[model samples]
Target: MATESAAPSPFEDQVLAHLRNAEAAYHAEQRERARELDELEATRAALAESQTHARLLTAELDAQRWNAERERQRVECLKQAMREIHGALFHGDVYTLILRACLTISGATRGIYVTCTRPDGPLRVRAHIDIPAIQGAAPPPMVAQLCRDVLAKNDTIVCSEADTAARLSGDEPQGLRFRNCVAAPVVLLANLDGVVLAADKMDGEFDDRDIEALLSVGDQATVAVRNRHLERELQTAYVHTVTMLADAVEAKDPYTHGHCEMASRYARLVASRLGLSEHDQALVCYSALLHDVGKIGVSDGVLNKPGPLLPEEVELMRAHVRVGYDLLNHVPALRDVADVVLRHHEHYDGGGYPDGMRGEDIPMPARIVSVADAYCAMITRRSYKDAYPEAAARAELRRCAGTQFDPVVVDAFLAILDTPEALDGDSDDFAECGLLPGFEAMRAQASPV
Candidate 1:
């Protein structure tokens, strides 16, 4: 049935619109919340990643610092080792420093430095550390062979326990000595050959570090030894050159042909008897040899005068001391010896040529030369005076002791003269040194000048 048409109510329409708006606002709020949540998650992940990278960077920095410290320590250790090796003065000192440094660096339980002057000779152990004492003991068979091998190849070797065992024969016992070793050759000179070996590390097997250490030590030792060898050669050459110059001075006069040699021997013996050190004895001996060197500057007329010298002539003869001192002082190496040379003619009681330094003022070496020089003069024959008998010479020494020479030195020389074959042995020594052709006849002559 159709009824009259009904119009829509305003309240219903307004309510429906409000509900639609509310639903739309709820959906928009949900979408905005989701976007905020997504942004939060991304920020958290970025924070986590940054923190992880920071941790890794921190670790790397720590590693770098640790490595730097280790390298610094290594360099410092090497410097100290160089000091020890280079400071050494003699061959034995160098050998000891090398072995000790090796043992310390490698932490070896046993170590040895073996060398030989001749290629074919057996290895001689120059230095060792932590070795059980065995009388007349030689190196173990394997070690000897290893040293020879190292010497031949000039190689640096790092051997493990297995390698050590393999080097031995199959029949040999297991777990033998020298289970691990670091060995290197010390090769520098043609005449010298050596091997430095460190064995049985306390903590671990031999490694590259140990081999490097051994090689470094061997290199240091080689350099030090080479320096000492060169120094010795230079010193020998200098001695020969000076001795020849002194010899030239003597060659000018036949009467004084061997005067310097005789004086040198006497001075050495007297210096030793006086308890002087070997170094001091050498200085005195050399000074005595060159005491008359300046006599070459004197004219032949005055030098070979058959009678006593006039006042002026005596002054000229005495000037030889100053001339010798000046000649020696010009050489830098002889400056110290020149000091002694200048004072050799000084008398104990102050009556002498040159500066006339008296008593204890004279250098001990020069004082020693004085006694030796006077003694030689008393026993030697000259154109002006005959050689005094030994008894007369001794008496003259005693009479002139306090006045012209140091009494203590004179007493020491007198004691040496009292040895059983002392005076008799002089003849053989004189002949050996190419002294005047007839020393026996010279000793048989009359009074001293």
Candidate 2:
């Protein structure tokens, strides 16, 4: 029984060994598959991290690009404003340009330029732009007060919706419904010339960026204002110099004591009555004043001769027109009127001296000055003649209309003389028709008197 049992167990033992080996091989395959899966997962995780980092870098780069673009736009806008401001300065339109530049730079729907005529005077609108709904409306009291504050502090005021509400919510009257407002002073040499205001931003509430842009525009406006101020000063100086020269000429002859002034006033009146352009009016006025300036080249004997002039003295007197033309033609500012001055004594019939330009061939300004000179001379006593009565002067002007004067100018002047305004002694001061368009107030402000 023992020998048979031992012989039969060999097959069973071999089968058991095979089964154990198969189980070990299956475990080894499972371990290899698990390790491969872990390695694949680690690669996937690393790829995901790289993608996230790339996305973050892209977002940062986009943000930087946006910031750079915004800065570029800001700089471009400021540069454009500066260019416009300089153009305005060169052209003498600072008030209008300030409002336009502020509206452009700040993206405002409404803008106002206010200036105080005097240091203590109330603010007056120099220029303004508004939406249709608020057209022709006066500036809100609060807004005006804000402008005053800018003048007072010599600083800028920026008001958001909340800030505007807080400021206007109190006892102050509020007619404005704007969501934003910006105001800056037009300063020059530490003196406040005026305040520039912008309101109702078209895009959004005004922020520090808008404020800073407005400040740059204000700085440009300051330069323009200073330039305008300098130009005004220079113009005043030129006017004074010309007036003194005229005065000196008149002083040399007692008979001509107010002749230049009378001629200028008459010329201005004639120009207005003729509906001449302001530039032409100015030309006529200045030409009449300086018509006799060439007399400075004449000898005292020739200029002050109480009796009729001999042919030689008359030739010398006639030389004054050419002399004045030569003298003023070289001056840049007076060049435009030099021809007018030279031809002021010319006759309408081509019988006059110098160029003998006739009718329309004569410059309109010169013709106007000619009429004025004749009128002034007829009414005022000269070295060779006594003053004529108004009626006699009018008759003389009418008699010489087609010969020594332009008939149209004579008629216009005669009509002006008939007006009640011409009878008023102070009418010259009230007559602003000779002022350039939109420059009457500016000229008045610059008047030294």
Best by TM-score: 2
Q: Write the per-residue lDDT of candidate 1 for residues 175-247, one digit (tens) a residue.
A: 3456688887765544446777888888867667667766666555666777657645755565665677687
Local lDDT at 317 for model 2: 92
lDDT of 2 by residue, 322-410 (tens): 98888777665666667888888789999998877788988888888888778778888877889999899999999998988888988
Where is the poorest 10-residue window by lDDT in model 2?
429-438
Task: Name the best candidate (by lDDT).
Answer: 2
Off by over 4 Å in 1: 1-78, 89-96, 108-145, 157-182, 187-193, 198-207, 219-226, 418-449
In model 2, residue pairs whose N, Cα or C atoms come closer than 3 Å (at least 3 residues apart or on different chains), thus clashing, are none
How high a TM-score does candidate 1 get? Answer: 0.64
Clashing pairs in 1: none
Measured over all alpha carbons after superposition, the RMSD of each candidate to the real structure, in angstroms, is 12.5, 7.8
TM-score of each model, in listed order: 0.64, 0.69
lDDT of each: 0.72, 0.74
Weakest ten-residue segment in model 1 by summed lDDT = 434-443
